[model samples]
Target: MNQTYTIKEKTKQIFVLLIPILITQLGMFSMVFFNTIMSGKYNSSDLAGVAIGSSIWSPIFNGISGILLAVSPIAAQRFGEKKSNEVSAVVRHGIYLSVFIALAVIILGFFFLNPILNKMALPARVEKTAFDYLVGLSFGLLPLFIFNVLRSFIYALGKTRVVMVIMLMSLPVNFFLNYAFIFGKFGLPELGGAGAGFATSITYWIIMGMTWFIVKTQDPFSSYPVFANMREFSWEKCKEILQIGVPMGLSTFFETSMFAVVTILLSKYSVTTIAAYQSALNIVSFLYMIPISISTALTVLVGYEVGARHYKDAKQYSWLGVLLAILIATGTGVLVVIFRYQVAGLYSNETAVINLTANFLIFALFFQISDAIQATAQAALRGYKDVNLAFIMTLIAYWLICLPVGYLLAHFAGLGARGYWLGLTIGLLAAGIALSIRLIYIQKRKFTHIQVKEVV
Candidate 1:
C-alpha cells in the first residue's frame, strides 16, 4: 500500500511539473510553427529557405544550450544538499559559459557559414534566401543562450511554471512580429522569409528580459540569489561544467545534426521534398515535447534524489520516467497517424507537400516511441552524472550506425526521402535499446552495493 501511494504521489508530481514544461516547450515551438506557416504562405521556396537556415543554426544553438544544461542537474544536486551559495556560483559559471559559447558560435558563423552553404550547391535562389535568413537569425544567438541559462536555473529549482507563463506570453508577440515583418505590415520592411529570422531574434530578447526580471524579482527564486558575486570568475568551476556538459552538447549535436544532414541531403532532390520533409519533421518535433518535458523534470527529480543519496528513489524515477514517456508517445503517435492528413494540411495547402508529409507521418509514428524512450533514459543518466557513457552510446548509434545506414539506403539503394527516414527509425531504436540496458545495469549495480553494505 505504501509503495502504491509512493507511485501515485510521484506520478502526480511528474504531471505537475510535466504539464507546465510541456506548455513551455510547445510555446517555444510555436515560434517555429509561425515561422514555417508564414514562410510557407509566402512561397514554398521561402519555406524551404527558412527550413534550411534553421537546420544550420539549430544544432549550433541547441548544442551549446545542451552544454549549459549541465547547470540544471548540478544546481539541482546542490540545491538538494541545501547549498544555496554553491548553486548561485554554479549558475554564474553557466552564464559565463553561455557567453563564451555565444561568441564561439558567432565566430564560426562568420568564418564557416558561407563556405558551408557554397559547398551544399543549392539552387541560387534558395541559397541566397537561406543565407540572408541565417544572417538575420544570428543576431539572437547570445540572447538565446542567456535565456537558456536562466531557464536551466529556474527549472532546477522547480519553478517551472514561471518559465512556462513567460514562454506562453511570448507566443502572440512572436506571431505578430513574424506576420508584420514577413509581409511588411504597418510600414515594416517586406523582408520575406528572412523577416521571420528578425522577428524571432527580437522576441528572444524580450523573453530573456522577462526571465531575468522574474528571477530577480520573484519570491521563489529570491533565496537562491543568482546575481550574487556576478563578477566572480572560476576556471575550475567552468571546467567542471564542461567536463559533463561538453559530452552532452556533442551528443545533442550528433542527434540533431543527423536530421539536419537529412535535410541537406533531401535538398539535393527538390523543394517539394524538402518542404514535405520539414513539415513532417516539425510535427514530430512538436509532439516530442511531451516526452522531452517529462525527461527534463525527471532529470531534476532524479538529480535531487541522487544528491540526497536516495539511490533507490533515483532508480525508480528513471524507470517511471521511461514508462510515462512511452505511454504518452504511444497516444500521441496514434493521434498523429489518425489525423496525419489534417496535420499536414495545417502546415501548407500544396497537394504534393501535403501528400508527402502525410506519408512521412507513418514513419514518424514508429520512431516517436523510440525517440521518447531514448530521451528519457538519457535524461536519467545525466541526473546520475553518468553522462560520458551516454554520449559514447549516442555517437555509436547515430553517427556510426544510423547515418551510414541512412546514407546507403537513401543514395545507394535509391529509396530517397522515405529511406532516410527509415534509417532514422532504426537509429533511434538502437539508441533506445542501448540506453535502457545501460540504465538497468547502473541501477542493478548500485542496488547490489546497497544490499551488501546493509548486510555488512
Candidate 2:
C-alpha cells in the first residue's frame, strides 16, 4: 500500500509538471505554425521560402537552446541538494553563455549568408525570399537566447507555469503581428515571407521583456535572488556549463541538422515537394511536443532524486517517464493516422501538397514511437550527467547511418522525399534502442555500487 501510494503521488507530480511544459512547448511552436499556414495561403513560393528559412535557422536556434538547457539539470541538482545560492551563479553564467553564442550565430549568418544559399542552388525567387527572411529573423537571436536562459532557470526550479503563461501571452501577440506585417496592415508595407521573420523577431523581444518583468516581480523567484550575482563572472562555472552543454548542443545540432539537410535536399525537387514536406514535418513536430515535455520534466525529477542520493527513486523516475512517453505517443500516433488527411489539409489547400503530406503521415506514426523512447531515455541520461555518450550515438546514428541511407534512397533509388523519411525512421529506431540500453546499464551500475556499499 505504501509503495503504491508513493508511485501514485509521483505520477501525479510528473503530470503536474508535464502539462504546463507541454502547453509551453506547443505555444512556442505555434508561432512557426502560424507562419507556415499564413505563408502557405499567401503563396507557394513564399511557403517554400519559409520552409528553407526555418530549416536553416531552427537548428542553430535549437542548438543554442540545448546548450543553455544544461542549466536546468545543474540547477535542479543544486536545488535538490538545498544549495540555493549556487543556482544564482549558474543563471549568471548561463546568461554570459547565451550572449556569446547569439553573437557567434549572428556573425556566422552575416559571413556565410550568400555562399550557403548559392551552394543550395534553390529556385531564384525562393532563394531571394529565404535570404530576406533570414536577414529579418537574425535580429531576434539575442533576445531569443536570453529568453532561453531565463526559461531554463525558471523551469529547473519547477515553476513551469510562469513560463507557460508567458508563452501563452506571446501566441496572440505573434499572430496579430504576423497578420499586420505579412499583409501590409496598419500602414506597414507588405513584406511577404520576410514579414514572418520580422514579426517573429518582435514577438521574441516582447516575450523576453515580459519574462524579465515577471522574474523581477514574482515572489516565487525572490528567494534565489538570481540577479544578485549579475556582475560576478566565474570561469570555472562557465567551463562547467560548457562541459555539459557542448555535448548537449552537439546532440541537438546533429538531430536538427539531419532534418535541415533533408529539407535542403528536397529543395532541389520542386515547390510542391517542399511544401508537402513542410506540412507533414509540422504535424510530426506537434506530436513531438508531448514526449519532449515529459522528457524535460523527467530530467528535473531524475536530477533531483539523483542529487538527493536516492538512486533507486531516480531509476524509477526514468523508467516511468519512458513508459508515459511511449503510451502518449501510441495514442497520438493512432489519432494522427486516423485523421491524417484532415491534418494535412489544415496546412495547405493545394491537392498535390495535401495528398503527399497525408502519405508522409503514415511513416510518422511508426517513427513517433521510436522518437519518444529515444527522447525520454536521453533526458534520463542527462539527469545522470551521462551526456557525451548520447551525443556520440546520435552523431553516428543520424549522420553516419541515416543521412547516407536517406541520400542513397532519395537520389539513387528514386524514392524522393518518402525515402528520406524512411531513413529517419530507421535512425530513430537505432537511437531509441541504443539510448534505452545505456540508461539500463547506468541504472544497474549505480544499483551495484549501492549494494557494494551496503556490504562494506
Candidate 3:
C-alpha cells in the first residue's frame, strides 16, 4: 500500500478485499441456511430440533473460530512488516493452536452437553434430535478448526479469493450430502434434522482437505512450507497468539451466546415460535455477513497499515470500511422492511410462522443498523490490536444489558420474540456507539504518541 491513499483509492482496496470475503462468508453461512430451510420443510419438529442444535453449537464454533481469526491480523501485520519467517512460523503455530483449542472443546462438550440440554428442558423429540445432531456434528470439529487456521493465514496474505473458491466448491458437496443423508437417499439411513450435522461435518473435512492441498501446492503459499519442515512449538509465540486471541474469542462468544441463550429461552414457546425465530435469524445472519465481511477486510487492511507504521492509512481504512458497511446495511435493511412478508414466506409456508417472522424482521432493521456499525468498528479495533477493552465492553453490552433487558421484555412485557430483538438492538446501539468513539480516540492517541516520539 502507499504511504497515503485517496478516498477512491481506499474504497477500491476495501472493495477488492470485501467482495471475495463476502462471497466466502455467504457460502459458509448458506450451509446452515440450507439446513434450516430443509429441516423446516421436513417438519416443524425437525426445524425446531435443528434450531436448538444450531443455537447450542454456533456460539462454540464461532468463539473457537474467533480465536483462530487472530491468525489473520497477526499474519497480516507480519506480512506488512515483510518478515517472511515470522509470518510462516505464526501460520504453523496457528495450526497447532487450533488442535489444542479443539481438544478442549471436545472434552468439555462430553461433560457438559447433556446437562445443558437437560436444563433447557426442550420437548422430548426436539431434545433427542438436538442431541443427536450435536453428536454427529462433533465428528468434524478437529478438521473444521484446522481448516479455520489455514483460512485465516491464507486470507491474511490477501488470498481471499482462494478461500472463496474452495468454499464455493464445497457447497455442492454439502448440498448433495444433506440431501442424501437427510432423506435416506443413496442407501444412507434417514436421520432427519440430525443429518444436517453429519452432512456439514463431511463437508468440513472436504473443504479442509481442499484448503490444505491448495496451500501446499499453490504459488506463494507453497513457499511458506506451512506443513513441511515443522519446528518445535514456541511458548512465547503461542502466548502472543493467545494474548490477542482469547479476548477476541470471548467477545464473539458473548455476542453469539446471547442469541443462543435467547433461543433456548424461546423453547418454552410453541415449536412455531422456535422455527420462526430461527428462520428470521438465518436471514439476519446472512445479511450480517455483509458488514462482517467488511469488518474482516478492515482487519487485514488496517492491520497491514498499522504494522507498516502508517497510522493514517489504517485510520482511512477504518472509517471507509465502516462507512461502506453502514451504507450497504441501510439499503438492505430498508429492502428487508419492504419485503418482510415475502422474505418470511421463503422460510416457511405456515401462516403464523410467516407473520411472526415478518414482524421480527421489522425489529431486525434497528438491529442491523446498530450491528453493522459496531461490527465494523469492532473489526477495525482488532486491526489496531485493541481487543481487551473491546471484550469487556462487549460482555457488558450483551450480558449485562442485552440479555437482561431482553428477558424482561420477552417474559415480563409479553412482547415475545420482538422484545428480545428490541433489547438486542439497544445493546448493539450501545456497543456501536462506544466502539466507534473509542476508535477515534485510539487514532488520536496513536498520532499523539508518534509526535511525542519525534520530539523526544
Candidate 4:
C-alpha cells in the first residue's frame, strides 16, 4: 500500500511541476510562433530572412540559457538541503555571470553571424533583414539571460506556476507588438521582417521586467533576498557553475547547432525549400515544449532527490519523467500526422511551402520520440552532476554522426532538406540510447557507494 501510494504521489508531483513548466514552455515558444507566422505572412523573402536570423539566434541563445540553467539544479539541490542562504548566494552570482556572458555574446562572440550570411550569397534584402533582426534581438540578450537565471531559481523553488502565469501574460503583449511593428500599426514603423526581431526584443524585456518585479514583491520569493547584502564576486561559485554549465551548454549547442547548420546549408536551395523547412521545423519546435518542459521539471525533481540523498527516489523520478515524455510524444505524433497539412498552412499560404512541409511532418514525428527520450535523459544526468561525459557523447552524435551524415546525404545523396531531418533523427536516437546507459551507470554507482557505506 505504501509503495503504491508513493508512486502515485511522485506521479502527482511530476505532473504538478510538469504542467506549469509545460505551459510556460508553450508560452515562451508562442512568441517565436508569432514571429514566424507574422514574418511568413509578409512574404517568402521576409520569412526566409527571419528564418536565417532565428536559425543563427536560437542555438546560441539556447546555449547560453543552458549554461544559466546550472542555476536550476544547483538551486534545487540547495533548496532540497534547506540551505536557503546558499540558494540566495547562487542566484546572486548567477546574475553576475549572466551579465558577463550576455556581453560576450553581444560583443565578442557570435561573429559568425555576419560572415556566414554574407558568404551564403542571399538576396540583398533578405541579408539586410537578417542583420536587422539580429540587431534587435541583441537588445534583449542581457535581460533575457538574467530572466532565465531568475526563472531557474523560481522553478527550483517549485513555483513553476508563477513562471507559467508570467509567460502566459506575455503572449498578448508579444502578439500586439508583433502586429504593430510588422505592419506599421499603432505608430510603429513597418520594418518588415526586422519588426519581428524588434517585437521579440521588446517582449523579452517586458517579461523580464515583470518577472523581476514579482520576485521582488512576492512572499516566498521575497524572503530569499536575492539582491540583499550581495556578497563580493566569488570565483569559486562562478567556477563551480562553469564546471557544470559549460559542458551542459555545449551539449545543447551541439544539438541545436546541428539544426542551425542544416538550415544554413539549405539556404542555397530554392527559397521555397528553406522556407518549407522552417515551417515544418516551427510546428515541431512548438510541440517540442512538451518534452523540453518535462526535461526541465525532471532536472529540478531529480536534483532535489539527489541532494536529499534519496537515491532510489531520484532513479524513480528519472524513469518516470522519461516515460511521461514519451507517452505524451506518442499522442502528439498521431495528431501531427493527422493535421500536418492544416498545420503547415498556418505558416504560409504558399502552396509549395505547405505541400513540402506536410511531407516533412512525418520525419518530425520521429524527432519527438528521440528528442523526448534524449532530452529527459540528459536532464536527469544533469541532476546527477554528471555532465562532462554526457557532453562528449552528444558531440559525437551531433558533430561526428549528424552533421557529417547530413552534409553527405544532402549534397551527395540528393536528399535536399529531407536529408538533414534524417540525420537529426539518427543523432537523437543515438543520444537517447547513450544517455540512458550513462544514467543507469550513475544510478548503480551511487547505490553501490551507499551500500558500501552501510557495510562499513
RMSD (Å) per prediction: 3.7, 3.7, 3.4, 3.8
How much does candidate 1 score in TM-score? Answer: 0.89
Backbone clash total for model 3 is 0
lDDT of 2 by residue, 342-367 (tens): 99999898999998999999989888
Clashes by residue pair, model 2: none
- Residues 1-456, candidate 4: write the lDDT tens digits: 011127788888888888999888778777877988898898788888988788778888889888999999998889877898888889888999999998887875357678888887899989988988888888888889999999999998888999989898889998999899888898878988899888989988998899999888997888898988765778898888889899999888887877777877888999999889988887888788889988998999888877767777889889999999999998998899899899899988999999999989998899779989999999999988889999999899888888888778878899878888888888888989999999999999765444111332
Q: Which stretches of candidate 3 lie over 4 Å from their true place?
A: 1-4, 37-47, 122-125, 187-190, 264-279, 348-356, 407-417, 447-456
How far in Å is the alpha carbon of 45 misplaced in model 1? 5.3
User: Evaluated with lDDT, which candidate comes out highest?
Assistant: 3
**lDDT accuracy of residue 28 in candidate 1:** 80
| Local distance difference test, each candidate | 0.86, 0.85, 0.87, 0.86
lDDT-based ranking:
3, 4, 1, 2
Score candidate 2 by lDDT. 0.85
Badly placed stretches (over 4 Å) of model 4 are 1-5, 39-46, 109-116, 185-190, 265-277, 338-359, 406-419, 447-456
- Candidate 4 CA-lDDT value: 0.86
Candidate with more favorable, higher TM-score: 3 or 4: 3
Please write out the lDDT profile of model 3 over residues 1-456, one tens digit for every residue: 333458898888788778999999889888988887787777788889998898789888888888988998998898888888888888888888988887888899899999999998799988888888888888889899889889888877876889999999999999999888788899999998899889999999999999999989987788786786576788888888888899999899888888878887888989988988988888898899899999998998888887777777788889988888889999999999999999999989999999989988999988999999999999999998889888888889899888889989998999987789999999998999999988999999764445111332
Model 2, residue 158: C-alpha shift (Å)? 1.0
